[model samples]
Target: MTATQSGPRISTEDFRFAFRSHPAGVAIVTADAGDGPVAMTVSSVASVSIDPPTLMFSASAGSSSTPTIRSAETLVVHLLAADHVELAKLGARRGAERFGDDVHWGRLPTGEPFYPDANWLRGRVIRRLDVEGATIIVVEAVEARPRDDGMSVDPTPLAYHNRHWHVLTDRSMLPPAVAPFYAVYGRE
Candidate 1:
């Protein structure tokens, strides 16, 4: 039965509409296949733990980068800054060589693609769950590098909601426990 007439049906459009209202931090998840690098823009990144340094993010199963991501030995998740709109757009795009000359990127020792200008966590996939239409991947952080350049390290995150990009800049009010660290280390 259709959602409107049904017992337990959920409309995809309605679910998407609800999600569109929730703002999420933007990030780029990158990995390298034997041929080259592949990536996708995702806002689903979430920290799962500190003990194991784990994080999770969802990637579309239909994405061109999906095969590479699934086959890759490691993944690099770059937390974007407010100024990374262009990179966000580029990563969001489908098909074509994303690591073209225009993109400033390098390779990690493990051969995963890396973006130096953002706070990034590189890790090995520990688990994968087939959920809805996406692949929910859990990665254990093997290494993490914060943006070292003074620029773009303001902690103002690049966010997405309702099909639009936004810069979350208001950081005046922070939790007491987090404020001290926020002031000292700044945002990532």
Candidate 2:
């Protein structure tokens, strides 16, 4: 048992602060609602099982898009490249502006529109888990492919740390190939 057992419970602010400091790759979790393209910025997207080709992402309980994403049968999780940091902010913003004309989107074979350039993994909804304050979307990968011109994951990732976007480059840390687990996006 650690200090957590005798808890003065971790404050949400403190938890968020700690979580923010730990770098995470950003992804755009998207789907098409009946009306139009819908997506949200999610740092929690990840692969949970390889056997079934599964992935998961959590959405805030209060997000309006949560309902839409949950109701949809499938979704596309787009891995953000180093150059897509600005687009992450756009998806995270709260308002109709997120749906404005500035965004470029297209449909998948399922006719579900997604942000075309964000680099994606299309998945079918497997299950939904209602966590404390958010709903976790566990989806099984139906198709995993990169956008036509998307770079293979070897390019440096754009990460979020301390609530700011960062590029992973120390030149010194640049190896011929990144470690296997760190390979994200379309890098296989």
Candidate 3:
């Protein structure tokens, strides 16, 4: 069933509010198209496929980094952990100095700027679709790099919901049923 089949048409504010209640993982996208580097925080990143390693994210026209990201051939998508909440805020803040002297970022051999501290995937822009005031970008992942800290465990992921940042941990997990699928499949 679609919203059009329902009683009334959804307003823009109502659409925004509905998504606000949904939790999304946070990511910082960085691109450098020969001029300089630009970064923006987004919660729109999602895995589209696993065979070819594809992902998609929407870049809003309102963001200052949108133009640079659109023009770049390749970009880095940094999946933020709870420890990098400050970096996420830096990318989300409008007009903030994203790559200052204090910021620890470096350019990849392929020429895209990236944060080495975060688990990131570098990908080539495969497709771009402009819809409304945002551009939906599809990328084919070429390489992925994990944090250099040598930690064997997964870091607590950062999330965005209702205009606030959140962290996802094992404690947040709900008790599973007696015969969980993962347990039956011999997975945790």
Candidate 4:
């Protein structure tokens, strides 16, 4: 146990271990704040609302791109599929040249840098909250662009768990188990 200003808190190692056991969808967030484009892979992206088309993700202070992403007013969130595992790894690698000559990326008409290979959403940062050492960004999506290859149907989603990347496939899915209350309410 660790003591914080408020009260006893879980050890950092314990907190990390708990979260590491949980799987999360992978996304690469890109932004350009005049100097140049910066990209970082994140597993914290989550949908917050549908009516307002809002989403949120947390950027760790340790990431090299966190400052750029925090300062940029607009950004592109690439919802990576299993085919984008390499891209995910590239962005996650510390001190890696994300936009080097070999990498294929382009700027959206709206001016934010984006990876054309993955499905992406262009949005403006609506809110920024600094919690602990991480910055939590809330974006209101205005435009979405799917991949040009038309592979949208049932694309295998990329996920991160226990410090490893995994692809969610049909074979990995378990049979549906409905709760009694939900089943009585006609919910699947």
Where's the lowest-lDDT run of ten residues in candidate 3? 146-155
Score every model by TM-score: 0.83, 0.81, 0.88, 0.91
Error of 4 at 147 (Å): 6.9
Model 4 TM-score on a 0 to 1 scale: 0.91
lDDT of 2: 0.81
Report the alpha-carbon TM-score of model 1 versus the true structure.
0.83
Cα deviation of 122, candidate 2, in Å: 0.7
**Which residue ranges in model 3 land beyond 4 Å of their true spot?**
1-8, 146-152, 178-188
Going through the candidates in the order shown, the clash numbers are 0, 0, 0, 0
Where model 2 places Cα greater than 4 Å from the true spot, the runs are 1-7, 146-153, 170-188
- Candidate 1 vs candidate 3: the lDDT winner is 3
Global lDDT of each candidate: 0.85, 0.81, 0.93, 0.93
The Cα RMSD in angstroms, rounded to one decimal, for candidate 1 relative to the true structure is 5.8
Residues 1-188, candidate 4, lDDT per residue (tens digit)?
43467698888999999998899999999999999999999999999999899999999999989999999999999999999999999999999999999999989988999899898999999999999999999999999985555657678999999999999997897656633665778876
Better of 2 and 4 by lDDT: 4
Error of 1 at 89 (Å): 0.6
lDDT of 1 at 76: 95
lDDT tens per residue, model 3, 137-178: 999999988455563367899999999999998888867784
**Global local distance difference test of model 3:** 0.93
Q: Is candidate 3 or candidate 4 better by TM-score?
A: 4
**Predicted candidate 1 versus true structure: per-residue lDDT over 1-188, tens digit per residue:** 55557677668898898898899999999998787788899999999999989999898888988878877779899999887888888899776566889888999787889887778899999998887688889999999884455545456778898999988766545676766875677754
